[model samples]
Target: MKYPIIIVTTILLLSSAVNAQKRSAPDWVLETKEAAWQSRDSQGEANEGNFGDVWYSKDGLDWTELKSDVIWSKRHEQSAFVFKDKIWIAGGAAEPDYKLDSEVWSLKIPKRWFRDN
Candidate 1:
């Protein structure tokens, strides 16, 4: 009985030490609550029309910003999906009276991109 207690106590101490070593600086995560601009009108209040910034993460918790201020027009509430082995963005509105975007954009991610990352 004494040997079992000692073993359990030792295990607990080692576990605590391991957990302490794991503690590190917090990670930065981006969340999209609303669009870019802030305006008084109903259109402005709506969560639409964010700038062109792309972020990617293999694990959802940790994210990396791939690019910022992309060439594409900044918009929000857009349709994003994976089709034809490519990612597509379509039909979103921009700021200033929430103008609509008729254009569609598709990105063909190279096969090597996934393997190299």
Candidate 2:
């Protein structure tokens, strides 16, 4: 099956009510190795310092975690794009050492999963 090319964009405008407070982007990674680093510190291992949680938002205002601990290694600064009915993540720095990642990961998204707006 074929799917249309979908482009996602987000824009945030601050209003007076939110101007006094600090807010992170809605798509920010909520989980990472650092969240558990303190307890695992004594294990004699450096924090992998990446995130494996997958998330999706239809409206971009509300996001839900789609999966936790995906097949790909935890990474940041990865490039994410939709190609051939699949979402692909490629080439990000894996944490702890901040070394470059060469692996590519992708997940197929069914057309039925999307609704016409």
Candidate 3:
């Protein structure tokens, strides 16, 4: 009697809390693909070229393109990480050559990227 009532109340409270904690999905989706590229040594084609664009989110719901002028080239399978308050991207392959790049590029976060377009 009393035990059943307490159990029902606890279940209702837990369900309400779960419903309130639901989160909305991000605004932008990165659609990247490994494009086909001709190999240099005639070992067949290598699917290493990256075909996609970069996007940025201002509020997790509103997104915008990062602009093509800023990016050096389109690449995939690159290593990107944050260090010393900057975002670093390095060592990615592009089309035509598909050669592994040895260059490092960095963008200072917030200060460099948060400006109005």
* Model 3 per-residue lDDT tens digits across residues 45-102: 3453344344443322233445544554655555665556655666666556867877
> Tens digit of lDDT per residue, candidate 1, span 1-117?
122323332332344444324322111122222111111112233563244544443323233334423334655555665566555666666555567776576545421112111
Each candidate structure's TM-score, on Cα atoms with residue i matched to residue i, is 0.47, 0.49, 0.48
Error of 2 at 70 (Å): 3.0
Query: How many residue pairs in model 3 have overlapping backbones?
Result: 0
Could you say which candidate leads in TM-score?
2
Which tens-of-lDDT digit does each residue in 56-96 have in candidate 2?
Answer: 44433333446433355555666665556566666666655
Minimum summed lDDT over a 10-residue window in model 2 is located at 33-42
Off by over 4 Å in 3: 1-49, 111-117
Instruction: Tell me how far the alpha carbon of residue 28 in candidate 2 is from the true structure, in angstroms, after superposition.
Output: 8.9
lDDT of 1 at 2: 21
Question: What is candidate 3's local distance difference test score?
Answer: 0.40
